[model samples]
Target: MNPAQSTQPTQSTQEKQYFDLHTTGIGYLNRIREVSPKKGNPFLACNIAALSGAADDVVYTRFDCRVSGKEAEALVRQYEDAVKQDQKVLISFKIGDLWADTFTYTKGDKTGQTGVSLKARLLFISWIKVNGQLVYKAEKAERPQLEQDPSGQASQGGQDDQAEATSSEDSPAPAAEASSSPKEAPRQSAQIALPETVQLSKDAPDFQERKAALKQQGYRFDGQAKVWRLPTDAAKSAIEAQHQANAQDWARSAQATA
Candidate 1:
C-alpha cells in the first residue's frame, strides 16, 4: 500500500523455472560410464531417450544425467538390469540440474541427428511390466529395487535380482555420460528434466508493490497462506523482472541513506 512503491524501474534477469520437475516416458539406458569426480563415491552416468509417440512414430528427446542418493542409486541398478532383461518400464524423474544441450550423430558426412537433452538427478523406475505381466511396481515412496530378481519363463525369479543388479560394485555412478573421444560428431553438454517452479515469493522487499503488479498480471493472493498463487508460468518472466527492479531500488535507497 505504500505510494512510493507503486512505480518501479525495469529489470532483466533470467531464472529458469524447471528445477523440481516430474515427467513420465519410456527410458533408454543407452550408455553407462564409470567416473570418479572426487574419488571413492564413483558414479555411473546414463544417457536416455524419452519417447512421446507410438513406437512407429516416436519422438526422441535425449537426456544425460547422474544419480547418487541411496534410493536413487538402487533404482538405477534395477533400471540397468531391466534393460538387459528387456522389460517394458515407465520412469519418473526428479530433476536437479537442466539446460539446453545438443546431440549430433554424423553418419559419413550427410546423415546428421540432433535432439534436446533431458538430464535428471533422481530417477525412479516406478513401474515395470515384463511379458505383459506387472512383475514390479515401486511403492509411491519406494525406490525401484527387488528383494530378489524376477524368474524367467521357466524358473521362479526372486534377491538374486538385487545380487545381479549389484553392478555398482563393479561400476559406481553420479552422471553426465561417459563417451570415449570420438572424432565423429559428439554430444553437447547433457540436460536434466525437472519440474517447473512457481515464481511467486513472499519475501520480496517491495511486497505490496509486487502484490499489486501481480494482480495486474493475474496472480492471486491467498490471505490465509499469505502467498501469491499463480495458475501457470505464462507471465512469470515479467513478474520476475519486476522483482529484480524492486530489489535493486531497495539496495539503492539503503546506500543513499548510509
Candidate 2:
C-alpha cells in the first residue's frame, strides 16, 4: 500500500453549494434606464416600489434592481413608454440575490445623511397590470412549479395556509374599503394579491442572522402573526434548503454534546 498516497485527503466531487435569496411581490415599476458602467457592459436597470403590510396600511420598499434575465429586460423595455407617460405600471416581480447598499444622500432634505437602498437582480416578471388593466401574463410553461410536501400540500416552509390567508391583505384595498362613502363596484376587480410566502421560525439556529438576511432580501415581518415572511415562488427551494441545513447543524451540535 502507498502510505503517503493514503495519507492525502481525498477530493470529493460534490458540487459547490450556494445560497440564493429571492424576493417576489407585486410592485410598481419605475426609473427604467440603461446603465453604462466604466468597467462592465451596459445593462438595463429599474426601480420597483414593492407593497407590503395590510391593505389599508400598505408600505413600500424600493428596490433598485438591475434587469438580469433577457425576458425581464424585454418586458421592462416594453413598459418604458407607459412608465414615461406617468401611467402606473404594476407588475408581479421576482428579484434575486438581494442586498443592501448604503450611500450618503447628496440631495434633498436628508442631504449628507446615510441612506440604505435595497439592490437586486430582476429575474422574472410573472405578470403585469398597467393602469388597472391586465397587459401581460407569463404562460404556464414559464412559471415555476412549487414542490409538493409529504402532506400533499405545496410546501413553502409550512406557510402555504398563512400565505393564502394574508395574500389579499397586502394589496391595495378596493374602492369600497379605500373610502368611507359607498362606491359602485367595477365590472371586474382590479385588486392583485401578493406572492405566496414562507415563514421563518424564531427557534431556528442562527435565527437573527437568517432574519437579517431575509430582511436584506426584502422579506417582511407580520407583527400580527409574529412571523417573518418571504415570498414562496422561486425562493421555495432555497428556503427549504436553508432550513434543512439549519436542522442538520442543530442535530449535529446536539449529538456532539451528548
Candidate 3:
C-alpha cells in the first residue's frame, strides 16, 4: 500500500463535498433565482406657477451623505458644498395660502364701518426633505381670488343676538337672570382660550449644534465633512512654531556637517 497516496485526498473529493453542500443549502437556491431589480435613489421635484404667467422648471436632486452609506450619498453631495462653507442654501420649497381679512365694526355712534383688517401675507419655509428626496423649488405663487365673497357668520348673527349678548354682558346678572333681575353683577365669563405653545427640535439638533459650538470656540467649519478647522490666527501660530522647530534642527544638522 502506498501510504502517501492513501493519505492524500483526491482533488475531485473536495470539490464533490462543496458541490453537495451548495446544492443542499437554501441560500444557494436563492442565489440561483432571478436577480432583483436595483431600486434607484429617491429624489424630489417641485412644480411652481409663475405669478406673471411665465414658464417653469422641475428641480431634481439626490442626497449622498456620510451619516449613512449609499443611502445618504446623493443628499450629502447635494448639500455638501454649502455645509462645508457654513453657508445658508436653499433646502426646500413650500406652497400655501395668503389670507386677507376685512373688518366690520361700529365706532362711537357711527352706524357701520368697514375696512381692511389684515394685509395678505406669504410664508416661505426651507427644511430637509422628509421623504425620498429633498429639494427647494421656487415659482410664483398665485394669490387666491374670492369667487364668492366670504360671509361673516358672526357679523350676520343679527342685532337681536348681539343686543341680547351685550345687555347680558353689561348687566350685573346671569344671562338667564338678567332678563328677570335689573341689578346684579354680570356673571363672570368662564374663560378665554389661548393657543398652545409649540416647541421645535433645534435646527439639525445634531449637525447644526456641532458646527455652532465649534464656531463659538473660534473655529471655522470647512471641508465636505464640515470639519472644525482652526481660525487664521491659530493656524498662523502653529505654522510659525513648526517652522522655528525645523530651523533649529536644520542649524544643528548644518553645524554637524561643518
Off by over 4 Å in 1: 1-19, 38-41, 54-56, 79-94, 102-118, 130-133, 141-258
Q: After superposition, how far is residue 130 of candidate 3 from its true place, in Å?
A: 56
The lowest-lDDT stretch of 10 consecutive residues in candidate 2 is 184-193
Q: What lDDT would each prediction earn against the true structure? A: 0.44, 0.62, 0.28
State the lDDT of candidate 2 residue by residue for 35-124, as single tens digits: 875545678999887767656555566788989889999999998998877777778777875654434558764465534456678988
TM-score ranking of the models: 2, 1, 3
**Tens-digit per-residue lDDT, 12-37, candidate 3:** 78854311100000000000111122
Q: Candidate 3: global Cα-lDDT? A: 0.28
Across 16-135, the per-residue lDDT of candidate 1 in tens digits comes to: 554343443444444555556532356767666544444333344566667645665666675676655544333433444343332343664223433333445545554444333445
TM-score of each: 0.38, 0.56, 0.15
Candidate 2 pairs with clashing backbones = none
lDDT at 5 for candidate 1? 78
Q: Which sequence of candidate numbers ranks them by lDDT, best first?
A: 2, 1, 3
Query: Which of candidates 1 and 3 reaches a greater lDDT?
Result: 1
What range of 10 consecutive residues in model 3 has the weakest lDDT sum? Answer: 22-31
Candidate 2 similarity to native, TM-score: 0.56
Off by over 4 Å in 3: 1-226
In the order shown, what is each candidate's alpha-carbon RMSD? Answer: 20.8, 17.1, 33.5
RMSD of 1: 20.8
